[model samples]
Target: MKATTVQNTFDDITLWNKMREGDEKSFSILFKRYYDDLVSYGNSLSPDKEKVQDCVQDVFIDVWNYKEKVQSAVVVKAYLLSSVRKRIARLYQRDHIFRKSTSIDAVSFHMEFSVEHELIDDDYATKQKVLHLNNLLNNLPARQKEALYLRYHQGLAVEQIAEMLDINYQSASNLVYRALITLRKEWKGALSLITLLSSGSF
Candidate 1:
C-alpha cells in the first residue's frame, strides 16, 4: 500500500480528523498552518513573547497527547485560539505578578495597527490619515480591540468570537458594532479607510 500524504490544501477540520487518527503528517501540516497566527494572537494577549510561544507549543503538545480523547472541533482555528487563551491565562495565574487576574477577560490586549507606506499613496495627507487611524485602533478598549481583531483580521464570525471570548453573541456583536461606530464618530471622513481595514486590505 502506498503511504498516505497530508496536503496543506485540506481544510482544518479534515486535518484535525486525520490528526486524531494518529496521522503525524496531518498534525504537522496543521501546526505549520496555524503556528504564526496562534503566536500573533498569543502576543496580543501577553507581551512576553517567550511565554506566549511556550503556551502555544504546550497547546499543540496537549492536543497531540490526548488526541484520542479530545472531541472534534467545528472550527479548528477557533478551538486552537481558545486553547491558547486559556493556556496563557493559566500561566498568568501561576505567576505572582498576575495571581489576581484569574480570568482571560482581565488580561489586557495590546493590538496595534499599521499600514505599509507602499500600500497607500505617497502623499503626506494620506500618510497622516493612516497614522490617525492606527492611533484610533490602538486606543480602543481592550475587549473591543480583541473583538475587532478576531472579526476583521482572523475572519471569525461573531458567534465564534463570542465562544472564544466566553461572551454572549449580542455582546460580541455590540463590541464590533460599537467599535466601528466609535471610529466613524471620531473620524467621519475616514469611512472608506474603515471599510478597507474591515476587509483586511491593510
Candidate 2:
C-alpha cells in the first residue's frame, strides 16, 4: 500500500481501539467523519434521501451495538459501504422497490470520482477531455459502467465490490475486464491524438 493508505489504515485502527474502549468522544468523531460518505453512498443506491438516511442511521446504530463483537475490519469504509448496500437491499425487498419501477425507468449514474484528485494534475491533457470521455463512458451498459466506477473511482477491491454488488468474485473480475476492454477500444485513438497534439507532432 502507498504511504497514505498505510496512514489511513493506522488511523482507522486507532479509532477502532478508542471506540472499543468506551470512548464516547471517539465514537462521535468516527460518526461525524464517515456520516457524509455513508449518506452519499446511500443516496446513490436510492435517490430517496429520507429512506437513505434511515438506512444509514440504522446501520450505525447496529455498528455501535455490535462494536464489541465486530471483527476489526481491514478496510473500514468498504465494510460500511457493504453494510449500507445490504441494508438497502433488505429495504427494497420489504418495500418491493424494484416492482414499483419497470425496466424502462432504470436510472443511469456515472461514478462521482471519489478518489479523482489523486490522479489529476494540471499538465495532463486528459483532464481537459474528461467531460468528453465521460460522455463516451455513458455509452457503456449500466452494469459495465458501474463496475468500472467501483474499480477506478471508489478504489475498491474486486472482492469488496463483489460483496457490495452481490455478485461472485469471478463476475466482478470479468465485469472490470470487459469494461476496460470497451473503454480502451473506444478511447485509445483519442488518447493518442492528445499525446500527439501535446508533442506538437500534428
Candidate 3:
C-alpha cells in the first residue's frame, strides 16, 4: 500500500506512535490535519498573523524533532492547541511584548462570531442580531471568550480546555457557563445564537 493510503488508515494516536519510530509520512499527515486549526487558534490568541504562523510552524518542527521522546497523546488536537498557545506566549515574552510576569492569561484572546444570512430568512434582522451577538461576545472577559471558543468553536471538552488554559476544571467550566449565561441574559435570541454555535455555523 502507498504511504498516504496507510497513513490515512490509522487514527491520530496510531500515527503518533508511527511518527515516534521515524515515520515521516505519519508526521506529515498529523501536521496537515491540524495545521489550519492550530493557525486559527493561534491567531485568536495573538493578532500578529506572521508571529502566529511562525509559532505554528515551530510547534510542528518541535513535535517532529522530539517525536521519540513524546508520549502518545490521548487527545492530539488538545495537545497541539496547548503547544501552540504556549509557543505564542513564549515568543511574546521573548520579544518583550509581554512582561516577565505575564502568562497565557495575560495574553488577550479575541473571537468574532458570524451568522449566515441564509440561516435566517430575514437578512436585515439577521445582520442586526449577529451584530448584537458579536458585541456581547466581544464584551466578555478574555478568559471567558477563550473558553467559549474552545468549547463551542473547537468542540473541546471542559477538561481539555482546563488543561490547555492551565486552569482548574471548575474554573474552565465556569468560564464557559458564565459566558453562556451572560449572552443569554443580554440577547433575546439566545436560542438561535446557541443553535448557530452548536451547529458550528459561527
Candidate 4:
C-alpha cells in the first residue's frame, strides 16, 4: 500500500481521545497514521511537495496546540484530511499566486495502486493485465476516483466522503454511483481477458 490510508479503518475514536487527553504517544500514532495520506492529498492540489509537507506539519502542530479544546469526532480521519486541504489552500493564497490555484474544492485527485504479488509472478501476461487495470483506475476523474477509493479502500460511508469532499450527500452518492457504473461496465470484460490470458489462451 503506497501512501495508503494508514489506519486499518477509521475507528480512530480511541486514538483521538488519547491525543486530546495529552497523550503524546497517541498523538504521534495519529500523526503517523495520517501523514502519508495528507501528503498525497496535498500533492493532488499543488505540485509543490515542500509546501504540502509544511502544511501537513502545521496542521499537526495546531492539533497539539489546541488538542484540549478539540471536540469528539465521529470520523477523525475525515477531519484531518479536511484540515490538510484547507491548510494547503490557505498557504497557497498567502504565499504566491499559482497558475493553477490551490482550492480544496477544485483539487484534481489522482490515485495510484500497487499491483499484487500474484500479478508480479514470472508470468509477463498477468503483469500486463494488472498494468492495464492500473492505467484505467488512474484515468478516472479525480472526484470519481476519490469516491471509489474512500468507499472501497478506506471503508468510509458515502456521508463521510461527502463531508471530506465538501459536497452534498446526493452529489457524493451520484459521483460514486457513476464511478461504479463505469467500472462495472468494464469489469467483466477485463476479468475475462485476464482469465483468458492466464490460461494461455492468447
- The residue-by-residue lDDT of candidate 4 on 1-202, one tens digit each, is 5433534543589878888899887788788888987787777666888988998999999989999998876688777877887887677666657566656576666545444535355667766655675666667788887777667655578998898788899999998888767655654433443332223200
The residue pairs that clash in candidate 3, if any, are: none
Off by over 4 Å in 3: 1-9, 97-100, 187-192, 199-202
Best-fitting candidate, scored by TM-score:
1
Evaluated at residue 134, the lDDT of candidate 2 is 50
Off by over 4 Å in 2: 1-10, 97-129, 189-202
All candidates: TM-score: 0.88, 0.70, 0.86, 0.75
**Model 2, residue 76: displacement in angstroms?**
0.4
The sequence of per-residue lDDT tens digits that candidate 1 reaches over residues 1-202 is 3333334468889989999999998899888889999999999888899999999999999999999988986788888998999888877778846445577777667868664556556678877876787788788898998898888788889999998888899999999998988776655343375554665422
lDDT of 2: 0.64
Give lDDT: candidate 3, residue 171: 93
1 or 2: which has the higher lDDT? 1
Q: What is candidate 2's lDDT per residue for 1-202, written digit by digit as tens?
A: 7644533554666777677677666666667667887787677667689998999889878878878877766577777777887787677666766576322113334333321323444646656555445555666676666666666545688998787677799998998887667655645433442332222200
Which candidate do you rate higher for lDDT, 2 or 3?
A: 3
Q: Return whichever of 2 and 3 wins on TM-score.
A: 3
The alpha-carbon deviation from the true structure for residue 51 of candidate 4, after best TM-score superposition, in angstroms, is 1.4
Task: Give the Å shift of residue 69 in candidate 4.
Answer: 2.1
